[model samples]
Target: MTKAPHRRGADRTEAIMRTTLELGQEIGYARLSMEGVAARAGAGKQTIYRRWSSKGALLLDSLLSLHEPALDYPDTGDVVADLRTQIHAAVDLLAGPPFGPLFTALIGEAQYDPRVAAALNERLIAPQAAKTVERLQAARDRGQLSEAFDLDLAMAILSGPLYFQLLITQEPLTHAYVDRVLDALFTGLGPISRAAGR
Candidate 1:
């Protein structure tokens, strides 16, 4: 669908993005359009064009903005507990409105659009996921982890079950699931040993 003109470049772009996500939530991405976002955002067409220049770019920012900074990975001293916290954070995000359906729709769209794939990877994957990798690296360096640790495998183990429960089973990601998943993953991951009574 065609969107009306946007407000202006920077502020306009953000406004459009804000409006786009709102519209996306109200009406599924299938029905999304620049016009709807612009109208709702009170932006101008030229405003959006100046910043993004393409629907993919605009949509990318729109989707990315949903990630609040606090949602990013936390580097707690205890990796297992940290991983559990991260998993629970994901569940909390999925269980909420706009993120689950919005991200799911974006994932489906990414399959057909290479740009979307790259954008998704850059915005969502890199920041939070890379932090996990960094944490794993730290664990390895401290000799707390097995030499055979596969980072990719480790991350998958930490996150896979949660995704299975939330994405596949479409079940609620309760605290129980979080605890269970973390326990299973930690058993295989091999967290660093702690001193007694430390």
Candidate 2:
């Protein structure tokens, strides 16, 4: 059966996005080109342009695609432990081959272009990150976490240092580094009984 044009278009856009992401990982955002993604996806350049107005838009969608199955924060009913899992997951992701350059590109590019920044936060960050905040909020409701815990602040604790090391210093993010950050965060956010190191 012939797929509807919109369905076909959707599939092609997805393919292009995937191809663009792979290309970004290989070529870096500065060198990423629609022609490369189109050739890799077996589509024409016009097809890519028709769907995405610019490279930033395409890259934004590519980042958003990582969340299709959705990266949920592990809710182990213990906020500290769950946050540890989330932090480790993020560290592993940032250090992973696929996301390293892609993330570096998106974040760096977003810093320069307001439109890209807005689109990225809207289409990518909000969708997946909101879930992280909600999980922490749930812990707050269950009395597993303190009411004073800040989601944005907590998120900063989790990913900010990693991004800085990766982006600013251009240092490698390793498992040891991941564990260290989580260790410190858990130190502060640990249960009241353990927060005092009982």
Candidate 3:
């Protein structure tokens, strides 16, 4: 049976997003164009342009579609352990595969493109950061963190170093490095109970 028009459009959009990721992986975002994605997806350039006004917008949507499931903050009763697990998973995403290099490219694009910057923040960064903050707030509610804990500060502290290393220094986000960051953040600023140590 023929799919309805909207359903077919949705399917085509998915295919185009998938192609964006695959092409971004292969050629990197510097060389990825809507024309290339349309050619690869067997769709018209107008089709892609109709859905996304720019390469960054298309790549942002593609990254979100691939990454949303993998990036959820886990809650396993032990906030520290759960955060460790989630951060490690995040490091894996940032260091490996279709997400990492493409994300790096997207960040680079965002530096100069205000529209992409706004969309990236609203669509991806803000949502994911909110999830991390929610997880920490839950820990506070349960007394795993102090009532005085500055969760907003902690969130910035937790993520800032990682982003710095990833985007600026281009250093490795090793597990040990992540642990040290966690230990310093938890111990010095907001002291999660030593009992909560992994």
Candidate 4:
């Protein structure tokens, strides 16, 4: 049976996104082009252009699509542990092959391209930050975090160092590093009694 035109269009869009990420990983984002993606995806330039106006928009969607399925903010009763797990998972995702290099490229490109920056902020950064904020707010409501705890600062404290390691220092994002950072931040946020195991 022939697929409907809209269904076929959806399939083509998926193929384009998938091919874009694969090419981004192989050639690096600095060299990736919509023409290349269209060729690799088995779609015409017009098809890709119809869906995405620029490589930045297409690449942003590709990155978001790649990470969204695996991204989750855990709430395992222990806020500290949950945050650690989330951070560790994120580090693993961003430090591993394909995604690691791709994300690094995206960050670098974002520094110079306003379109990429805006797309990244809207599609990736804002959403993840909101999730972190939501988790911290939940912890506060449960008395795990003090009312005075600044959720925004907490989110930055959680993510900023990891990004620094990923982009600037190029240090290993280890479990120990995540734990140490979390411990230091939690120390200033107030102590939590684990007697009830929450």
Candidate 5:
């Protein structure tokens, strides 16, 4: 007879995820291990390994849980305002404690580990990019953007500077910086037709 899958309570799962994020922030993704997570979470090693195949998987789950709530696309009819809100939310999530350092570590580790790269891309990057694309598409449909606007390129342009400031320049991602980025992008992308006279 086949054995039934083991199910853990939500409390236990939250404990594990909380522990993983804490350790990830403190020690970083490269130094994080399932053993350490299990120990810190007050669970057995097999308990963690049984639930997650690797450290990357565990960390990915924790990261997603922490930041998923803020990943929604805002549809307030003003493309510039929506983009600003989205970008600001992203900066808040990725520039604050626990998530920020954990994200930085995962991104750094992903440079050398394909598994981490894939997980981060799939769980975090791709979804947020898709949301941005959707928002841009909506703007295009509403005649706020040029018909020939490239969504992929738009998303890259919108997000690239934030990541650059976050990871490369190590500069503060302030509100003024967000507004400047939006201003520059909107200037090149053309005026917001729908939001005129406001």
Candidate 6:
């Protein structure tokens, strides 16, 4: 059976995005080109351009498509446990391939390209941060956190060590490390400990 026009377009878009990711991983983003992606994806250049104005835009979309479901915060009524589960999952993702290398490359690109930086923050970073903050807010409403708790600072504390491992030290983002970080952050924090009854 013949596919509908929209279906064909969707298929082509998926193919293009997939090709972009593959090329990005194999060749690195600096070497990746629109023409290369088009040739590999078996689509025309205008097809990619029509969908995304630049390579950074295309890559951001591709990573977001793959990274979205992995980063969702789960509410188990235990805030620390939920954060541990989600943060561990996120650390694992950052340690692996495709998402790992591509996301690292995108971050590097963002250092030089303001457009990519803005798009990354606006699209992936901000939304994910907002979701996390919302989860923390819900926990606070449950009396799991202090009313004056800095959710934003809590977020930074949650992510800081992992980013340091990912970018600076180049050490492994181990499960033990995550646990240690969580333990340290929550240690003797009355409200959080009281809520979990730990």
Candidate with the greatest TM-score versus the true structure:
3
Q: Sort the predicted structures by lDDT, highest score first.
A: 3, 4, 6, 5, 2, 1
The parts of candidate 2 lying over 4 Å away from their true place are 39-44, 66-69, 190-198
- Taking the tens digit of each residue's C-alpha lDDT, what string does model 2 give over 81-157? 67667656666665676676776677788888888889877865676577777877787788766566787788777
Residue lDDT tens for model 1, 1-198: 645555334455566788777787888878887767767877777666676645656677876664553665566677777766776776666656656776666666777888877887787766767788888888777766765779877876767776677567877768787898777666766744456226
After aligning candidate 3 to the native by TM-score, how far in Å is the CA of 46 from where it should be? 1.8
TM-score of each: 0.75, 0.78, 0.87, 0.86, 0.82, 0.83
lDDT of each: 0.70, 0.75, 0.85, 0.83, 0.81, 0.82
User: How well is each residue in 20-122 modelled by candidate 4, as lDDT tens digits?
Assistant: 9888888887799999998888889998898887887788788787557366788888889888888787777777765877777777778888888988888
Candidate 3 per-residue lDDT over residues 37-152, each given as its tens digit: 99999999998898898999999888887567467877899887888998888888776664788777788889988999998889768887898999999988888788877888
Query: Model 2 — TM-score against the truth?
Result: 0.78
Best by lDDT: 3
The true-versus-predicted C-alpha distance at residue 110 of model 5, in Å, is 1.9
* Candidate order, TM-score descending: 3, 4, 6, 5, 2, 1
68: Cα error in model 1, Å: 3.9
Clash list (residue pairs), candidate 2: none
Lowest-sum lDDT 10-residue window in model 5: 1-10
> Which parts of model 4 are misplaced by more than 4 Å?
191-198
Instruction: Pull out the clashing pairs in model 4.
Output: none
Is candidate 1 or 6 superior in lDDT? 6
Clashes of 4: 0
